[model samples]
Target: MAVNNMAVQGKFITFEGSEGCGKSTQSKLLLEYLKAKGLDVQLIREPGGVAISEKIRSLLLDKANAVMNKECETLLYMAARAQLVEEVIIPRLTNGVILLCDRFLDSTLAYQGYGCGVPVEGIRSMGLFAAKGIQPDLTILLDLDVEEGLLRRGAERDRIELRSLDYHNRVRKGYLDMARKEPARMMVIDGSQAKDVIFTQMCARVEQLLS
Candidate 1:
């Protein structure tokens, strides 16, 4: 199976970016596009897609859990990921299902590792345990300015969203840095562009993998 790049196996494609980067929206569009093409595909949002993982997601995003430590937050994300990988990702990929995910390990690297002051190397090292050594074949990143991105989110932000602007800026930089390091695996798209334009670019990239 192709673990790191696009190949003929069950392709795991993840959409990543800051809070309002439109990763979720565009991922859904890609999901519908693939379905319309009669492809076997499904979409899974991180910290979700499974019963156990969803519970962890609740705790992770709850504003009441404001006292959650960076280390605690990091492990919780991993715990949720471990459940998700075991329950959703591994089996589907093994069955040759094209999985379109809203977020994955990259979010942890950006949010906790960079935004929360945890070490990037540590996040990568721990990610193996959570992801079970199965990584994305393609990672599509929706990049945009931190301020504009947060503005797009509007009110009713979650715990992570309520963090300081500096933290979010660090997270954004982390994503760009990761994308820069692995140009072949991660594709960067301008989130500020129109949805159709972004979807077109995303579709062209995905078609190459499907072909």
Candidate 2:
């Protein structure tokens, strides 16, 4: 892919976590914080951020699609990602625009592969192709109790969120395993901590990268 050779002048940061772990809120806050520091930053989300990808996101999340198999789910995610990478992410990063993504390739690995029993090796290969060689500079994985996270989500749950507790637990485990294997790139934060505390910790890690 020609996009692979493009110089990434800005940082690419992504947030990962189980449902209702506050990654969306945290990513938003980080976006604001980065803007306050006068940096050129934008917040985009997986399965979204572009018109085509956003439609795919809706299809993937709609509870009506309950019968969708793991293979179809995984392919849809990759389709959206490929569009997002080509349409928005690559060009922005090439122009030195810092990007804060709510979720990325890791979500597929955890949700479809680990949680839904899809083959991990296959997902990794597809993810690499979908992302077109654009890897996150930093990944913040927010760790939280599955039950508590579900409680936070309340009655409003998407297709993925409506999965069994065991499934979500497996997803969390997958995330932690990945973090353990790549400690330098993935930072696991205690999502149970106070919002301000978590924010501060996130800032510290991000600033270290910026410096």
Candidate 3:
């Protein structure tokens, strides 16, 4: 599907936030909205877009792997991302698909760097290599309180989601910190708002980019 606007190049938009912050829902809504507008769009998630990445994602999220070390976890995430970028992301973007990602490099920075006590600089350095220099044109960060987000998850929690409140708080702070540093590229939105309200804000921002 070719886009009508020649001015609108392939845009990489990422959604970032802690668990249960509704990034997935918002990204999906954006994807549908763009498609309805006759835009060539694709929605994918981090650590599990392609076959290899999906395999890695299973390992990463399995509650059985509770004892996985922080360094190993970080490297595994990077490995999955590298595979995804080479196999799925680059080709889709080159073909002019408006790519909407549920999470991306920022997840590694927030999860491993802040939540797991890894060095932020180190994660960024490794992320650059993994992502092959592909940065999001716009990143929508859903800011939500740690406790509220956890409560929203209730019983079904993945390995990452089962982490302590302190860890989740660190992750949330890391996301906000990154947004502050890159205000132009990252839009911080309140996740506690109504779903329609959140989507409205997202659509408004994305329309600006498309226009």
Candidate 4:
């Protein structure tokens, strides 16, 4: 269960997308499939479920903290990520588990760097430091149009999702850009399709990776 040995056995795969794009749904389906196949899997979401990360998530998402600055918000996200990585992700993966993260570092880059207009370099630096060089083996990006995605959510906007339409558009563009830049490590999925169709394709992609 040492770090070096874990890195060799475990695989990290992350799902990323804007709100209402069904990343969560797909992630759940994938997790179930992996479990059924008898693979050791761990599911984690950002901003998060772990003790320390959950506290940071509360601060980041609380409507009452409306005055939090953009940079401060980004840093808070990094803090949560650092804790989640150190406490949960690293340990679980080290035990040879397949880590299926609902949202990972890409969310920070999309929401903070592109949507909020923070410099991409700064966000990347912070992410690198937070994750301590751990990178997903594959990143599945569920791509969708901002307007269509917003309509799907139907008035259930969280603090991040409540941003301007223009901001959401930029975030989507940012994800596409990242996929393009890291073609070997990322796959862009058509998220506008029906849920079953998306799930089927997701399974195929995962099967191919495992094969």
Candidate 5:
């Protein structure tokens, strides 16, 4: 996949991994830390950050939409991302805001590209087009087993979460492969560690980025 890995003006960091990898928690923690230091920061999530994107998120996550076409689902995600990047991400970052996003292009590559069998090149083209050259400066991948991550999510599951174990495994492998290819921009953290330890390591990464 020929992804446009160009660096944007401000610091943009994204968190990625399988569902229920504690990224939400870690993101919030990092946000709190940045705020304490009085840095100008903005936090967001994929597929549901902005109002328009939130609507698309509901359709994508609804279990009743199991029959949704893979390509269609993929496009819907890109639509949400396009709106988010236009309405929220790009503007704030243009003013030099430090962005701590919960997820980004990597999720699509892992879920739809690897999980649902969409070609990486196609997803790359569509995603880069949608986001308008925006790319994270750093991506922290919280690596974990599919089973354990799902177990943490509990009985309630989204449509994507209900996919087969093999599918989830492929997604995890896809993330690892990306990390291997872009070690400087993507760090794979062991998600099985204690929450505090994980956060500490995450903080260290963010510190390095900020410094």
Candidate 6:
């Protein structure tokens, strides 16, 4: 279909996982696939890229900001999300684009609420408010063992990555909990496999959904 002629039944799909789980790579692959199939697609990531949001992202990722409190970090994430939603996601969706987001509100819940031991209720409420009730049509959680993921990433650990192993464990558990809670909306994919295998499984899942 021509991009301008496409109806605005936009679908939001998110790729999520701990560091080094290939969320970025998979998101890019799916985005390319959709575009090749003649679907309108938009690619975006959280905490950065957009002007105000990029500033917040830097703060979130900068080790100099290490003194930032857990609640504050969560709030900053929500702030960036709110701006992202208003400036990027909502507009693209309204224009009939398939949104392929690298990460979404789920990351905040996994990292902040579970990993940092913040209250889940508060985090959920904040996320809902920030997103204006917009939830992804599908969330692909690339599941992997925390230790394996960390080891695979090697020396490429960033600020968020420098967090304790226990924190990552909690985040992984949090993602599993979310999958259990929202089985229809979330699919857990094994990330220990080869990239092509993972991509094949993802394509299968998307076909099932779009069929």
What ranking of all candidate models by lDDT puts the best one first?
2, 1, 5, 3, 6, 4
* Tens-place lDDT digits, model 5, residues 121-192: 999999889988788889999999999999999999899999999999999999999999999999899999
lDDT of each: 0.91, 0.93, 0.90, 0.87, 0.90, 0.88
lDDT of 4: 0.87
Error of 1 at 153 (Å): 1.3
Tens digits of lDDT, candidate 6, 1-211: 1123433467889988888888988999898888999988888998765999999998899887778999899999999999998888877887777898999999999999899999989999999889877788899999999989889889876678999999999999999999999999999999999989999998998888787
Best by lDDT: 2
Candidate 2: 10-residue stretch with minimal lDDT: 1-10
Tens digits of per-residue lDDT for model 3, 52-132: 999999999999998999999999999999999888877788777899998999999999998888999999989878877
Task: Pick the TM-score winner.
Answer: 2
Cα lDDT tens digits for candidate 2, 58-103:
9999999999998999999999999999999888988888899999
* Residue-level lDDT for 96 in candidate 6: 70
Alpha-carbon error at 129 in model 5, in Å?
Answer: 0.4
Structural similarity to truth (TM-score) of each candidate: 0.96, 0.97, 0.94, 0.94, 0.95, 0.94
Off by over 4 Å in 3: 1-9
lDDT of 1 by residue, 17-119 (tens): 9989898889889888889989899999998789999999999999999999999999999999999988888879978899999999999999999898899
Q: What would the per-residue lDDT of candidate 4 be over residues 1-211, giving only the tens digit for each residue?
A: 2343344467889999998898888899899989999999978899886898999999888877889999999999999999998988887777778999999999999989888989999989888889877888888899999989899889866777778899999999999999999998889999999989888887887887777
Query: Least lDDT summed over 10 consecutive residues: which range in candidate 1?
Result: 1-10
**TM-score-better candidate, 1 vs 4:** 1
The window of 10 residues in a row where model 6 has the poorest summed lDDT is 1-10
lDDT (Cα, 0-100) at 40 in candidate 5: 94
Q: Count steric clashes of candidate 4.
A: 0
Q: Measured by C-alpha RMSD in angstroms, how accurate is candidate 3?
A: 3.8
